[model samples]
Target: MELKDRLLTIAKEIPPGSYPVDVGTDHGYLPAYLVKQGIVSRALASDIGEGPLLAAKQHIEALSLSDRIELCLCDGLTGIDLSDKTHIVIAGMGGETISEILLRRHPLTQTLLLQPMTKVETLRRFLLKHGYRIEKEIPAYEEKKAYTVMLARYDGIVREGDDFFWTFGALPQSKKKEKYLYFQSLLSRLEKKQKGLQKAQTQERTELDRLAILIAKAKEYLQEELYDHHSGNL
Candidate 1:
């Protein structure tokens, strides 16, 4: 099964030899692809709805992977056991839903591959505060939309109040170009919002003040990237 750019990015993050548990499996294409590629010996595909789960089952069978991939119909990881899985892939969900899934009890030892569709800042803050260390982030552009894939693990370290990384991300060196584009896009939206709020006389003006700070910080980081690469030559 061929995966989309976002899903493919998430797939590539899965470590080899990992026994993966794919949450919100939808049609189970990811697990099928992983198994077909020989990245993992086996996997568990799960979804909350019966329809999706049934669809996943059929897809797995068609691939003749029924013996390799297990299908479970459940909500999040509520009733599942994590001992057998080394990594968990939760993608194509809103950040809030991902946060809620993590909020519930689960094995801290399992690495997480998450791709939040919206409210990523909220998800990043939650992960940092909850002792999950983001090891790396990969950016994927598909269908004219940019997506972020995060690989994180429980390291018992809490990072707090880093708005720049929380709003954008502290991308790995390999993804510097992606990081620059993300920050640039974010800066544009924040600047426009700041301009609108500046014309208002309400207490909301405080938001504009906050936006100024964020705008300045994002610009500084982006400029630093340019100086580090181009130097006086630019």
Candidate 2:
């Protein structure tokens, strides 16, 4: 089972020998890939809906990974037991949903690989507030759309900040081309929003000012990264 770039990016973040439980395992390709490649001895794949779970079952069976990858029908992690798993992948979902799943009474001690389709800022904030630390972020491009795969671990440390770090990301990303382009794309979006709300109310104006500052700061960071790359300082 070949995975797309986005899914592959998420899969690569899962450590070897990890017992990964893929939340919302749409097609189960990730777990199948991991098992087939001998990256992990076993995994648990779960989906909220019957349709996706059925498809995942078929895909896992076709790859003959049924024994290595267990399938479960559950909402988030409600009906599944992750006591033995060390890694949890919550990808291809909205940031809000991912945050909610991590909050579902399960101990957030597992390493997490998250790929939020939207609202990455919200997801980052949630992680910071909930005592998780993002260890690394890798950017990938699929069909001209950019996606970021985040690897986080539960550290029980509540990160505090409301700056560009929260909006963009922690500094020193993997230094890939797509990573640079991802921040550029974020700058473009912030600029557009700032312009569109130029004549907004006082509260909106404050938000706009913050976006402006973030845009400038992101530009500076990218320039420094580029310079370091050229000078072999990265």
Provide the TM-score for each candidate, comma-separated: 0.89, 0.91
Could you give candidate 1's per-residue lDDT for residues 40-67 as a string of tens digits?
A: 8899999999999989998888999999
Which regions in candidate 1 have their CA more than 4 angstroms from the true location? 199-202, 226-234
Per-residue error (Å), model 1, residue 17: 1.1
Pairs of residues at least 3 apart in sequence or in different chains that clash in candidate 1: none
- The CA lDDT of each predicted structure is 0.84, 0.84
Q: Residues 179-221, candidate 2: write the lDDT tens digits.
A: 7777878888888888778755446767877888898888897
Task: Please name the candidate that would achieve the greatest TM-score relative to the true structure.
Answer: 2
Total backbone clashes of candidate 2, pairs 3 or more residues apart or in separate chains:
0
Model 2 poorest 10 in a row by lDDT: 225-234
Prediction 1 global C-alpha lDDT: 0.84
| TM-score of candidate 2 on Cα atoms, chains taken together | 0.91
